[model samples]
Target chain A: MVKLTLNVVMAERNISSQELAKAIGITPANLSILKTGKAKAIRFSTLSKICHVLECQPGDILKYVDE
Target chain B: MSKWLKIGINVLIMFLRFGIVAGYFMLIYPIIYLADAFQNHTTHAILNGSDFLRFSNNQQATLGAVKRFPSWPYALIMSVGVVLTVWATIKLLKALIKLLSNIRDQNYFSTSNELALITIIKAQVMMLLGDLLFASGNQLSQSWLLRVNTGVFSETWETCFHDVFQIIMLAAIYETYRHAMRVKAENDLTV
Candidate 1:
């Protein structure tokens, strides 16, 4: 299963979900959905914005695990 | 919106309304007639063979007088059938109408349809019992409530066959619907 480490990355970057959501131009609810691992997929542009704001690579926020 | 499905639903709604009204009257008229007979309490009430269906089983009758009967038992014996037919049709209409609206809302896999199927099956079963009641009313009454006649028995047997066939078909329909609902739920959860 594809998993997200976005919550860990956000905590390490010392950013609250609402602040990150505003900086990335998405809703806090959507950010919370992604943090909860309920998101189906994240857009590349949104990922890019998150990476830019948090100063991290995509690899830091995404991981894969065998089911 | 599928045009054909919408039209079909509309037509079905119209027919259901008509059936509801017709069924209501069929049920109500007999009760009212019996009520009138009870209120009047005529000792010498000689009813026609064809018009007075409760006394239709009487083997002996003519333009003159053959037998006079009380009001209550005769009405009670025969009205079971009219009430059963009307009640079942009304229930069927309600379930199907709910199913239609659920479909219109794009909800195919639902418990409401299941409820409809169960009601349909139970209604048929009750119809078989009603047929039996109609038949037994004549015999058990011992020519007091209703007269003894072969026509009643023959009609009971015919309706029994029809009810059994309908029950079989309804069971098949319920099984098919359960399968379809299962498949639909799987599809919905695939994402």
Candidate 2:
């Protein structure tokens, strides 16, 4: 199963959703959704954008946890 | 009016536009076929006998039966539909963008609004992409460079993309609704 753990990273880095949104050229609402793992799928471009802004990797934000 | 009411109106407007387009095509198709048939019949009749009165009457009837003014109503309806759809789409997109921006800027760490905003954005993107694909497919047959295979492939790709996008959008929407329900429950408890 695909699992995302962005919340933990955000907490660890003390990154606000707004900052992440601005940096990634997306709205904070989108960032918030991503943070909560409520998003069904992530655009590769958007994922790249987020990673670029958050100074993280895809693996850092997402993980494959057993369902 | 409420936001949901506005959305309903927008949907009705879209349906009206679709009906108008269908009606236009239905009206024009038989006329085109009849025109071709009449032209062929006239050519054959002229070869046999030059009955000027009958020929003139036929021409007059065809011209009179063409229904010129009906096009105006269709044009007007189509124009209005296009404007309404465009306006609604823009308004929704702007609202989504603004809400997302606000949520991010305000640094609201709560999950509910964030999830809703994300779902909204995904929905907008899917809608935009679907519209684009539809418009592109509509034009594909008109292009000289486009082959039947290419057109078919493009259409298939468009369908696949639209389906996948919709599925993702629906999933996001479900997640948002779940979060909203949870948030509402928490708020009720607090109150």
Candidate 3:
């Protein structure tokens, strides 16, 4: 399964969830969904925005894991 | 759903409910007459006196014709079945109306809409069971009592098949809606 490591990236960058959510122009609840791996899919544009806001590559926030 | 579409569907549901109530009254009228005449010695005269409704011999009776007087208990049971069938059909229509209203409000996949669909399926099942029980009781009563085939005993297998078909169709719709609800939830959760 594809899992998000957004928390680890945010923690390393000293960014709060609210800061990242607001920076990426998404609601905090939606960011929580991504952070908790509850999201079924992510749009390319949103991913790009998140990557830009977090100053990281897509791979830094996303990881595939065997379930 | 479009505003007009919702309005149209709601209107149709109300119309269907009205028809069910009217048909229920029609079915119950004979029972009411029979009950009223049960105390009188002229039960036969009162039943046969009506120009629009007359019971004839089994030989002269067609599918639409009423033949012979069912026992009072048989008639009562048949009336109960008709009541149940009509009640369930009306409930089913009500559920559909609720579902349509939910769709009109852009509340597709809401729990209330799912419950409404479930209610629709349950009502269809109730209708099927009520009809089948009525049919079976009619047969049993005919065999046990005066052997007079009255009331809905004359209903063909096609009617039973139609009821079963409707139940199956509603079940299919319920399943499809369930699938769609899951898809909608997944879509909603996606970022």
Worst 10 residues of 1 chain B by lDDT: B42-51
**What lDDT tens digits, residue by residue, belong to model 3 across residues B55-165?**
335433332323334445455655666667777877777777787677667787788888988898788777776677567645543343323334443433456788889
- All candidates in order of lDDT, best leading: 3, 1, 2
How many steric clashes between backbone atoms does each model show?
0, 1, 0
What is the per-residue lDDT of model 2 for residues B1-191, given as tens digits with 9 covering 90 to 100? 45665566566556656655554444443343245344544223222332212322233323333322233332333233334334434544544444444444553444545554565555555444544443443333213212222321123346546656766775777676667767765543320
lDDT of 1 by residue, B42-152 (tens): 212323222223544445443232334544654565577657766877877777777777787777779888888899888788777767656654444334434333442
Interface RMS for model 3 = 0.6
Candidate 1 vs candidate 2: which has greater TM-score?
Answer: 1
TM-score result, candidate 2? 0.28
- What candidate 2 gets wrong by more than 4 Å, as runs, is B1-191
lDDT of each: 0.69, 0.51, 0.70
- Ten residues in sequence with the least summed lDDT for candidate 2 chain A: A31-40
Candidate 3 segments whose C-alpha is farther than 4 A from its true place? B1-3, B6-70, B133-155
lDDT tens string, model 2, A1-67? 6777877877788987777778778777766666666666778898787678768899997898776
- CA-based DockQ, model 1: 0.07
